[model samples]
Target: MRLIFGLLYTLFFLGCLTTALFVVFHLLRYSLDRKVAVFGTVFFLSVFVILLFTNALIFFTLPLESLFPTFNTL
Candidate 1:
């Protein structure tokens, strides 16, 4: 059902976002070069945020029927 799918989708997004955050935290905590760590964390977090937004946008805008025609029968 759509509800289940939506829940799973949200959880997946959150999981990925959290993973990205963890990576950023580790980079900032462990990296030797301060400038590189800051820059890398910013760049990586920006890319991850952009990707998450794009995916959520596409997921909401895309027609489920087009993606799975057979589901229409249900």
Candidate 2:
């Protein structure tokens, strides 16, 4: 069904995006602080959740009609 596909896509994309953000944050935090890194960890997790939620909301509302126009015609 359309609803299931939409949900699955949204969840998959959100997970990837969140993981990417977390990895980048981890790298940056390590560079900035070699010791006492819990603050960075907490910040990374909080931001990840917020951004993931926001991205999911946007993806869920996106119109399916807007996809594929940029593909090269073969």
Candidate 3:
């Protein structure tokens, strides 16, 4: 069902965000060079955001009903 797929996608999206946060936190907390830490965080976050947004865009555009037309039928 569309609703189930939507829920799963939401969970996946949240998981990605949470994973990014942990990565950023570790980069900032464990790195020896402050400049490298900051740069790495910025670059990673930028790419991650762009990719995540693109993923969401593509996901929203998928024809779920057409893909799962028989899901609701007996």
Give RMSD to native, each candidate.
1.5, 6.5, 1.2
In model 2, the clashing pairs are: none
Q: Which portions of model 2 miss their true places by more than 4 Å? A: 1-11, 14-35, 66-74
Error of 3 at 12 (Å): 0.6
Better of 2 and 3 by TM-score: 3
Q: Candidate 3 lDDT, tens digit per residue, 1-74?
A: 77889999999999999999999999999999999999999999999999999999999999977887898673
Identify the runs in model 1 with alpha carbons over 4 angstroms from their true place.
Answer: 72-74
Question: After TM-score superposition, what is the CA distance of residue 20 in candidate 3 from its true location, in Å?
Answer: 0.6
lDDT of 3: 0.95
* Native-structure RMSD, model 3: 1.2
> How does each model score on TM-score?
0.85, 0.47, 0.91
Best by lDDT: 3
Report the Cα lDDT for candidate 1. Answer: 0.88
Error of 3 at 65 (Å): 1.0
Report every candidate's CA lDDT. 0.88, 0.68, 0.95
Extract clashing residue pairs from model 1.
Answer: none
